[model samples]
Target: MAKLYSKQKLAGQSMLPKKETIAFILNYSKALSIKKIGKMSFEIIAN
Candidate 1:
């Protein structure tokens, strides 16, 4: 979970989604792609 207060403090009291949140989103997306690749590879081998 992203800490809203910490993000606000980091941005000098500015309002934003926070860099951590963006990084988490990016990382999650990459993980999803990796999972998809694994599944595809398994399907190919099974076929």
Candidate 2:
């Protein structure tokens, strides 16, 4: 997950807000992926 965030940052993609907890980011990412929400990537959702 850290690697993912780092890559996203490097790519200038949206990231999980710094004010948000890591736990929140992980769970939210999981939930979205599991539900296949919007067929979007985490980067898009983070934005």
Candidate 3:
């Protein structure tokens, strides 16, 4: 599960809800920015 402080921001960016798990089939060869947050954790997962 992921946690987010701003649901509006996510919505504005067309991202899924924090508690929602999303699955995609597309593969990217470029860099992307992803943020992961938990109750006591904050992480950035990107490539």
Candidate 4:
């Protein structure tokens, strides 16, 4: 179908997944939470 073709083209262009999309997948699918610990350092809390 045309939709499938467009999806494949977009995937080849590396423009389908944005930063937020990746972050959401990692943040929730991994069962982890992100919190502000310091200015630069990051802390991973299990949910």
Candidate 5:
């Protein structure tokens, strides 16, 4: 996803392993689904 790519860029770190990115996206989506956290964008999360 774009968010994942952006995160990798923002970190200035080497590319994250595919599995780790996938897991993070899954968990993040689950968290979003469970609660209506407002305006929690990728930029916020990355920081």
Candidate 6:
């Protein structure tokens, strides 16, 4: 998923909800800025 984060720096962006599972990301990837809220838990920090 590090690739996703780095890609965000390239200029283009993606729209996203406030929360999503990593598994969903694995299937359909988006470089929305997210932060881990707990072990195996993450939240969309920005759109």
Give the Cα lDDT of each candidate: 0.59, 0.57, 0.45, 0.68, 0.60, 0.56
Give the Cα-based TM-score of candidate 1 against the true structure. Answer: 0.37
How displaced is residue 22 in candidate 6, in Å? 23
Q: Which stretches of candidate 2 lie over 4 Å from their true place?
A: 1-20, 34-47
Write the candidate numbers in order of decreasing lDDT: 4, 5, 1, 2, 6, 3
lDDT of 4 by residue, 1-47 (tens): 35555556554665477889899888775876456766665657576
- Tell how far residue 5 is off in model 1, in angstroms: 25
Q: List TM-scores for all candidates, in order.
A: 0.37, 0.28, 0.15, 0.31, 0.33, 0.19
Counting clashing residue pairs in each candidate, in order, gives 0, 0, 0, 0, 0, 0
lDDT of 4: 0.68
Candidate 1 vs candidate 2, TM-score winner: 1
Per-residue alpha-carbon lDDT of candidate 1 for residues 1-47, written as tens digits (9 for 90 to 100): 76567545554766789899999888776555322564473222211
lDDT of 5 by residue, 1-47 (tens): 34556555565767667898999888776565332458553433322
Which model, 1 or 4, shows the larger TM-score?
1
Of 1 and 5, the candidate ranking higher by TM-score: 1
Instruction: Residues 1-47, candidate 2: write the lDDT tens digits.
Output: 24555445566767656655877778787655322358753443433
Candidate 4 lDDT at 1 equals 33
Model 4: residues >4 Å from true position, as ranges? 1-13, 32-47
Clashing pairs in 1: none
Candidate 6, after superposition: displacement of residue 36 in Å? 0.2
**For model 3, where is the 10-residue window of minimal lDDT?**
20-29
For candidate 6, what is the TM-score?
Answer: 0.19
The positional error of residue 36 in candidate 4, measured at the CA in angstroms, is: 32
Instruction: Give candidate 5 regions above 4 Å deviation.
Output: 1-17, 34-47
